[model samples]
Target chain A: MTANPKGGRYRAWGLIVPTGVLYAVTFGIPMAMLLSASFARFEAGRTTPGFFLDNYTRIASDGVTLQVFWNTVTLSAQITAVGLVVAFPVAMLMRRAGPGMRLALMFVLVSPLLTSIIVRNVAWMLILGRSGLINTWLMDWGLISSPLALMYNRLGVIIAVVHVYLPFAVLPIYAALRAIDPARENAAASLGAPPWRVFVHITLPLAMPGVVAAFTLLFILSMGVYLTPVILGGNFVVTLPMMITDVARNQYNWPFASAMSVLLLASIVVVVALASALNRAFSPPRND
Target chain B: MTERSGSPFGYAMLAIFGALVAAFLLLPLVILCIQSFTAESFLSFPPPSYGTRWYRHVAAAANWREAALSSLVIAAIVTPLSLVLGTLAALGLDRGPMRGRGVLYGILISPMILPHIVLGLGIFRIALDLHIDDSLLSIVPAHLTITVPFVVISVGASLQSFDTGLEKAAQSLGASPLRALWHITLPIIRPGLVGGGIFAFIMSFDEFIITYFLSVQTRTLPLEIFSTLRYQVSPAIAAVSALTIAFSAALTVALMMRGQVISAGRIVR
Candidate 1:
């Protein structure tokens, strides 16, 4: 049955109208314009509207673009993988802790998220710099006579990116683990299954949805990461966002930059779709 | 679940994981705080001497002050506007029997999932075409696109759990629709609205990409910090970072506290 008796549907329509107009003007039109701009040419302080495929062709053939594509994919995957491994057990521990301890841990875990990305990257720059804490501590302990190059490298970029995005991984996994009844694990244990076996066969599978969600979230975030790589990678590594920035803002090549952004968007959508499909395929069968 | 009194390995593993995660999260913020006290003019770690010179410098720098002010002003404007608009949208969508509601909601929330860099570029091009480029007005609309979805989700969740029967009862008691909404419905959802608005404010304040693109004449705090990092690494930036961190952390704590109070009230009821 319908909730409203009168033909007062116009009241709801009235409320939606303002928001719809704003969304259309701000989001919808621009997104469509961006798609069209990817195919047009911009030169000599003028944009020539046309159906040109040259921008996409350049992206396909360019070595830098290919490297950026691969780098973006691999880096996103690596961060998602590493973050899950680190976050899962921590979330489990958080689940079992007392209320005070859980709150304290949550605070600590989410503290990094509160800071600006620029600040977080700078902090990493200090810690991972040549004469930074890690190198200094290593030298004092006689682990190495020379300071290792930690900052402005791929390893450093991954470390910093993971640091910033870890909360995204932790929070979802923590929520999922909390939802799983502890009694299920106890039941498995009472049925003579070992702890490791129970975790592997039951708990891990149940938490797969969380894993998928975290992976998708982290992967998407990592793909668009600009500041971390710009700060930590120095002139060494370049991601798609950095490339897009250089092309669009620095060089004023709107068409080429639009093309690259469109490619990045398409790739992100494809990855997310694949993830959803995989999650559905592996999801536990429902008992009716 | 009783605490297990066995397995030293379990306790050791827990301790190690907790310590590592804490270190990973806190190290950067702590290091940034420490570096702000460095005596040198450059970004030299393990400074020979410690002082608050950078804090003084940050206090005096006009550009830094201007950027911080612009960020505050923009966030102040964007937060409340987005909240009202978002709440209206959520209420309408939740109450209505609109066709393709799921699809419409997905479309509405799509902005959150779209990359900021792309949005930044789109807005950059749009503003240029519209001749509104490099203005504070431009930044507000861009911030709204990101903030509105958050308000919709949070407020919509609250609305879903609310009892509409109360509204009907109020109507039977001769209360007008507007009056019922004002006196009854709005109070019940106030917590969610506040929480969501705070979330939106924090997101806009910490936003970097959109501001970096859309802003040319005006710089937000994040844009200023980004520019400084490119030319010179200094302790003043760290001080700014520390300030932003403290502000956001306070807001987060307040939101979480409000959440606890609301849930506790639910339990009592």
Candidate 2:
């Protein structure tokens, strides 16, 4: 609606064309290929040249795949829940802290985001190994007689996933908390509401958008996360990403892998779609 | 804000909790630094003897050096490519009164939501069909798929907040459109561009899953470390990890000193 939008359209095209072409070749076309390949027939570790529903049939009929799918959903839900709980208090402190303390906390909190997940997992293995740091410390304190199985299990993966993705949850909630006016909380307290009551009634509802946004992000990221689970969950723990890789590489079943990939992508899309619908229905509007 | 935070009990709780979270976050980096100094090679909780032996071992590994160099070269290529492309797209979104802008913007950033393995596998399939999978050239596109979305999001944020009146004023004063952009628009958006570029570089440097599918002739440091850990880890693995952590910390400090938040981080803003 601005003046000279004709020129604007031409300018936009010039600026956008190169990236468009690049993505067309790299991402757009590849996605099309993925979809097409998913429905292609599979034979002897190679994709044949026609459409088939064998992949879908197998995915539906195989009880183990269903179990693994449920397991993945459960683990991701657990990680999102735990990460949100742990991140809430920290985000509150970050919002309320003085400048110096805030900067220090931000640096520490953001460090893990910058550090490679590989290194994080490697260090987790070192700390969670049978005779690792936790065991050594417990022994020193006479807390336990034998080392515990901490790494290469479901519990370890959950812990490490939470650590890696914690910041993702905290930052959004912190931003929301920071954006809240202090006057509202102060007014509530001045009107005789207790501190806890002020927080529960005023602050929590206002920060719900951020909480939802954070959960959505964490859930999606958890769905795609491969390295954390691979490093910590070992062989038995098969998330979709891991399973996709196994079918593609180890089994040399590209079509089946493509099918799984499509399923994973669809699941995440569905999650966000459903969440946003709920968000639209439930979230209070901001007049600002 | 005043009464509660001033109370000793509240202050103590917040401070202690903050410190505990920081320690939890840095626990791995701290442990890696310690492990790199251990003299023994078999991996023990406490070092039998503390020395620079593992660091020295890492210094001598030719493959490790090559992997590091390859990573740098790829990141060097990816950063500028992503920055230019991303900035332009952001510019378009900012300046153009185009229809379906939302649709266009969504398409531009959809790769961010796509799973890495899916993108990698899809790109790999295409590359294999094109017979380009055996070259380092092929992997750059794969890396870009992941990094470009970050650039668009970051640079787009900066562009959205930029004032357009200055550029219009420059144009009225006889400055060319490109000139106004160069002299006014670009400078204002420099922080965004720089932040996007840094993110593009780091993401490319650390990317392994995409490279895993696409890498045939070249290997990056993360790929090397992954294999090393998966098959057999030497004490040198610890050293390599420590060195990368040091690099990340130094980069972080440099950005912090300049007061730049590198807003392109996947962490929600």
Candidate 3:
């Protein structure tokens, strides 16, 4: 934190050169090509080089494209909201646990991440089927007259999404909650503030930065989500990412797909930037 | 420590919600594991009988064997490359007096922000242009774009808190700069490097989108599983999926536990 020696400059450059050069050539070049190719014309499984606004114009004017975009955005927002609401309490509980128990809990929560998205969603297919576990259990308990359709719908997608992505939401808020000096909360509690009040005034405020960070991450992830929605919701519900893949792979419409991708990426960037800005406004200056 | 100071009613609520959520998170994986062992022809949970039938099918499937090997080979190749490059970048930024370091840092981690589908499309587009599509080599760059960030963030965090005085002390004792880095600095941050390597390997191995976009002739395990599932809902894929889930969990725990104890090296930390 205090000093930088004059001597290590060459060594530093040596260290940075590989990834930097690698990224520039591979990542950098591809991105340039993508930007350029997005304007190219696509016909009969082939693309030709040219400048064209038709790709972007089609993305803008198509009613289905507009609806898919709106739906993706709204679904992402909803998923982000749900994940935060659910993860906040779990994170609070995690912070409340002992070290060993906390580790165990962490392992449990992260187990879903260990499974492939395909596997998890496949499992969801079985679990959310009309005769799936929830429905069957409910029927057994005389809580339902018949099996409820949970798969191949928005509700199915949302439930699976929330379950799969819940850990992303929990870890950040837990980090934020864990970082707080317990004395602040204790101070509020000891001053006759009830548990709810203390948490609202002190603990909740402290963890807000983490909540915002988690929300941003989750929102972007939900926006970019392709596999889970398609696997669970089937053809009926199409998110933009799914649409992009469908267009590129099936329709062989690279330019339109690229245009959609560019727009999706731009929107994600704007939202993330806003979220980070909001996070900064909510949190105090870094102790560092 | 004062987290326990909340009211008893609050603690009760925490316990109830925690159990419910944990169960919800775990139910699917558990069902899959059970369904994989089912002797029934169809994948109905609470199977009529259980056996090793599906497991045998998954093991004997030729395409699955190919896909699994491809995934491992690709991940094995990417892991060390990512570690070396990522460590170097982290070291350069952390120790070096580089201007515009934030910009450089952002550029390195930008892949994390760009959605998987976008990056996948970009890589696919470029690959098609260059006629490198469907090659294992083509998948490498895409995986790196995502995996390298984990290394940067992991090693960078470690380097931030590292006692640089140790490196200086080693140098002062007549160790060369590289020698000091190898003997002193690297040992202290070995956890980060190891952790980063593990994360990179898993990420590359588990990645389907990039693989989906790139690989056609040589499918990864995920691609194969996807195709198999798309065609039919057999328990054979469930067996493979369960095995993969086990392998992944085992690999991560084995690596993490075998490493030196650095609290920051853990994913959450």
Candidate 4:
């Protein structure tokens, strides 16, 4: 690469200044405000500006909030787990498919992600609601006498979340699967190891990086989910973000909401750190 | 190496599993599209009759029209603003001094992963204190925080594969920097630009949570659909949802036709 003239270096940096300024105004200042507000006190249904750990303390002792937090964590884990199971086979298929087949598979997966979350959830409501497709078909076929309690529950939320996040799970695993040298598996096969054994020993270990990455990504996204729970869960299921929104919007408890937001952000940080540590622990030793 | 993919049994299992997963992905959208054509008032599978009555209803509703207009206006503003900002940030990251590049890149892209509800809560507080809560003044900036990351990442992907030699050659021939960039660099990165632009537009259009926090009198298309869905399971919503699906599907096709403008991996990453 040719060295740019001295003036060009500064110009290159200058290009970033606009975005930096935008972030400062939009993201940076607001986050700072949120952090400070989390320390403020709320009493008698009014928020007073001052330093207090009351909000954080409430998160621990208030009892209801932490349950919802745990519920959110459990739901996120469930979605991530289910997503990995379904996505693994699809990723494997993508790795083996021809270019045309791969593109078609990518289209099916990515199109859902690009579609509006509300639209996708609405579609799910039509498919899973009382008079929706599955129920109607079941009743018509005499398979059941009544509609299943499919929508408006944890199961519906999991199904919808998993559907949306499946692509997130598949792509990374597929990338990792493609990155693997087939020769390793072939070598294992030539040594008289069966296909499933080779997969267990070679493919699964090699694909761990992508699997971990997908889990991290899915869990993070699932934790932040607000609309899916509201729409698909019929507001019967409350996640962390749903609680934060309810507090801030309906209750007007800005400090409490801000505190919850901080907690959510902290949990995300922990997840990221844990995932990276796990990635390091599970990584195969490099040969080169 | 290629012949060692197990027996026909394994292939059959994978194929069956893959097809099932694909069906799972497409079933909702396909069902919604079919349900949108129902002539009946409420949602039901295998709709009693097929017609465009809901489409007519959506077209006739003033609130739907207004929300769609507001979304378009906001997306119209957000698209160009974010594209310019994101491209500049991406360019700086690619060509700038090689110090803290990773940190800077992470910071720029952090908005993508940061929970929208948290960001919405922060923006809501600030907007309320400023008394600009329900206006474009607050909403536009909120949209920018999220959409800019897509542009940065997508454009950054393009810039990574870009060759600097052509620009250097143009400069050596006495072209000014701006002239060389306009004539050489812009065309080469057009695919990224197009992809990033569509991404920004769609994101701003579909954004719900932050807009929900910021808007009281103002409603975007998704907000309208959400409110409607919350209160009533109307067939008109199916029509609106169908339109949105079509909008995304058409744009996705455009990206595909643009020939590897952005991959699902790059976008997800």
Q: Give the number of the best model, judged by TM-score.
A: 4
The DockQ values of the predictions, listed in order, are: 0.44, 0.54, 0.52, 0.69
Q: Model-by-model lDDT, in order?
A: 0.79, 0.81, 0.81, 0.88
Candidate 3 C-alpha lDDT tens digits along A1-288: 113556655456567888877777667786777777789887777888899887888888888898999999998988898999999989888888777767666766766665678888888877887777678788999999988978788889999999878888888888898898878778887788888898888888888888988898899999999888988888877899999998988798888888888889888988978997998788864555
lDDT of model number 1: 0.79
Between prediction 2 and prediction 4, which has the larger lDDT? 4
On the 0 to 100 scale, the lDDT of residue B232 in model 1 is 49
Q: What value does the lDDT take at residue A235 in candidate 2?
A: 79
Clashing pairs in 1: none
Off by over 4 Å in 1: A1-6, A42-46, B1-12, B39-49, B260-269
**Residue-level error in angstroms, candidate 3, position A207:** 1.5
Per-candidate Cα RMSD to the true structure, in Å, reads: 3.5, 2.4, 2.9, 1.6
Lowest lDDT 10-residue stretch of candidate 4 chain A:
A1-10
Q: For residues B116-171, could you state the per-residue lDDT of candidate 1 as single tens digits?
A: 89988998888888888778667888899988888887787788899999987988
List, residue by residue over A1-288, the lDDT tens digit for candidate 2: 236768756667568888898899999899999999889988776678568998888788887666777778888999999888888888888877888888887788767777788888888888887767898789889999999878778888988998888888888888888778787778788888876787788888888778888888888889888888998888757888888888887787888888888888888988899778867764765646
lDDT order, best first, reads 4, 3, 2, 1
Q: TM-score (0 to 1) of chain B, per candidate?
A: 0.87, 0.89, 0.91, 0.95
Candidate 4, Cα interface RMSD: 1.8
* Residue A68 displacement (Å), model 1: 1.4
Look at candidate 3 and tell me the lDDT of residue A162: 92
Model 3 off-target regions past 4 Å?
Answer: A1-4, A41-51, A139-145, A284-288, B1-5, B255-269
Q: Provide the DockQ value for model 3.
A: 0.52
